[model samples]
Target chain A: AQSVSQHNHHVILSEAASLELGCNYSYGGTVNLFWYVQYPGQHLQLLLKYFSGDPLVKGIKGFEAEFIKSKFSFNLRKPSVQWSDTAEYFCAVMDAAGNKLTFGGGTRVLVKP
Target chain B: EAGVAQSPRYKIIEKRQSVAFWCNPISGHATLYWYQQILGQGPKLLIQFQNNGVVDDSQLPKDRFSAERLKGVDSTLKIQPAKLEDSAVYLCASSLDSYTIYFGEGSWLTVV
Candidate 1:
């Protein structure tokens, strides 16, 4: 079975600090990667997705992720963090033929203003 | 568009009781999914529906959990004889094709 792993359980960052959340998946076949964010009381919102294009995918709110196939990783990163970036981030992966997604244990990011 | 819609934002029930949650997918979406999210964990896929037919339900606890998409528009997930461990947020999502899932405000269930 496919599974996703998020190494960082919780991340605290000062304003303007660079952010990176590690995500690794256990799948060898073609896969689709996605980053989703959930605010305090909001639903999960898509940050970005990686299908077949370039490895680096840009998402809304200055978020981006690079899909490295050899490493089986798709890590989320942001150049500068803001207080509004405080939320729970989840990394998900789906096999080519599977419609279901396997999500990693989320990482809570707290950005201090 | 109207993302996805789920009713009963929160539900509380005793163990061995039953509860049901509904989900309305985005307009014209063909694929819908139900996920169970425990506190401090990412959502886990419980079931998947491609229109009115179930595509995958390998993770669903069939003995107590059942879901259906009758008209291919709205879906309902029911948990009979719920247990304390069944307390989680039930998330509904829809996608146009296969990827890019749009999620709704999940239904939180608390099984005491």
Candidate 2:
């Protein structure tokens, strides 16, 4: 079965700290990768997605993710974090068929002001 | 454009009870999806519909779960004889094609 894995279950960082959330998928074939974020009591919002082309894709809120095909990873990164960045992040992948997204367990990020 | 909408925001039901959730996808969208999201986990696809036709229901527990998209517009998801493990947030999403999936504020279901 295809699956996504996020290594860090919980991450705490201070404001202005650099952040990286690891995401890896277990599928060799072509895949579409996505990163989504959910603030407190809010709906899931798309942060970024990699369909094709440039491996490094920039998304909303100063967030970016790089898709490394060799590693089968699309890790999200942010240079400077803000307190408002606190949220639960999820990594998802879909195969070439584009049926349904297979999501990871998710990572809880807490940024201290 | 308005995003997908789902209601009620929250529900509390007893075991063996029947509950239904309503969802209105983004206007003119041809694809719609329903997902079950347990606390601390990502959303799991329950069923998908493409203009009133079932696209996939492999993950849906059809024995007690049923969903329908009539007229290829609004949709409804129902669970009969709900179990405790059924407690989770139900999410509804829609897409123009298939790559981009926009989700709505989920309906939280708590089966006690």
lDDT of 2 by residue, A21-84 (tens): 9999998688999999999999999999999999999999999999999999999999999999
Q: Against the true structure, whose lDDT is highest?
A: 2
Q: Give every candidate's TM-score on chain A.
A: 0.97, 0.98
Kindly report which residue pairs in candidate 2 clash with one another: none
User: Could you tell me which residue pairs clash in candidate 1?
Assistant: none
Docking class of 2: high
Interface RMSDs of the predictions, in order, are 1.1, 0.8
User: What's the chain B TM-score of candidate 2?
Assistant: 0.98
CA lDDT, every prediction? 0.95, 0.95
Which runs of model 2 end up more than 4 angstroms from their true locations? none
Q: What lDDT score goes with residue A76 in model 1?
A: 98
**True lDDT of residue B104, candidate 1:** 97
